[model samples]
Target: CDYELIKLRSVSLEALGENEPGASISRCNTLRCYPAKVPELIQNCCDYLEKNALQTVGLFRVGVSKKRLKELKDQVNLNRSLTFDVSTNAHDIAGLIKEFLRELPEPLLTRDLCSPFLNIPSS
Candidate 1:
């Protein structure tokens, strides 16, 4: 069982690397610009959210169906133009954005920066 779990984890990580969201930012081939730093997946999600989800009450707090979220992830991972509709649930895209950030190989906040960030007092 342990061996099987490890094998599955390895396969999942390998697939994650091959996909867009979890890929190393520098090497990611999707919608990269010469000087712009944001990944296309993130940019697209933010754009959609800005346009549609700004007034949403529980924007990030709400949970979405796993099957729907998976479908959205698969679409984003394709690196193709956004195919999901504008009418699509905002929480679904928000969930996808959260998943993308979570899956990054390195934490968005690096270890060295974590201490400094944590030390800062709340405003």
Candidate 2:
């Protein structure tokens, strides 16, 4: 790997509201966000959906980094708002899914919609 991609696992965004917004995110499961591809890791952490259970969860940054100029100036996809598919806020993901699936009449409830396919280290 060119750069270190840290994975913070089992980080619950649903429980933690948008408190942090974009600054350093603290979750109930994992620790400091290293360089790992955090998005995929969070998805894999989710357990199988159970009946009448809150299987739908999303993660997002509680606070935004003060360094917002980097993304706009560098034109990079990395940013505090939401850099990867695994959001810092579960509601963010839910909204995204809901905009499409929110009203879907099918079995969207059971659907384990992964953010996106990424080649994360199988550690």
Candidate 3:
């Protein structure tokens, strides 16, 4: 399992290095940029979403471009090794988080939670 994880990591890292127009690398070294861990991205997103439930509806108002999605993923993975701060732009970060969630290859919320999630009493 460890070897597979390492292999996947290296493959992903290698993939990130490739550049394209408007890709994450293009934005790197610009706008208050730094690496961010996946969990940090998730937490930042959760915090923002929890506080501003209405934003979720607006999130889909603007169609997320591929460039933006790539940039968001890059930022999250890049910051994995660095110290986190709340200095990053919240609007952009929130959009990125929403896009990340939408683009996930698999559902983050597992089957176990589906029924409970739906059964939650609506306030």
Q: What is the TM-score of each candidate against the true structure?
A: 0.68, 0.18, 0.38
lDDT of 1 by residue, 56-101 (tens): 9998889988888777755654544356575588898888777666
Per-model C-alpha lDDT, please? 0.60, 0.30, 0.45
lDDT of 2 by residue, 3-84 (tens): 1122222223322233254423544222333234333323332321122225443332233332432222122223212343
Error of 2 at 76 (Å): 14
What's each prediction's clash count?
0, 23, 4
Model 3 lDDT, residue 97, Cα: 56
Cα RMSDs, all models: 7.4, 16.6, 12.1
- On a 0 to 100 scale, what is the lDDT of residue 45 in model 2? 28
Error of 2 at 42 (Å): 14
Q: Point out the higher-scoring one by lDDT: 1 or 3.
A: 1
Winner of 2 and 3 under lDDT: 3
**Highest TM-score: which candidate?**
1
lDDT score for residue 52 of model 2: 21
Q: Over 4 Å off in model 2, which ranges?
A: 1-87, 102-123
- Output the TM-score of candidate 1: 0.68
Score residue 48 of candidate 1 by CA lDDT.
Answer: 85
- lDDT string for model 3 (8-52, tens) is 232222223343343355232222222432333355566665765
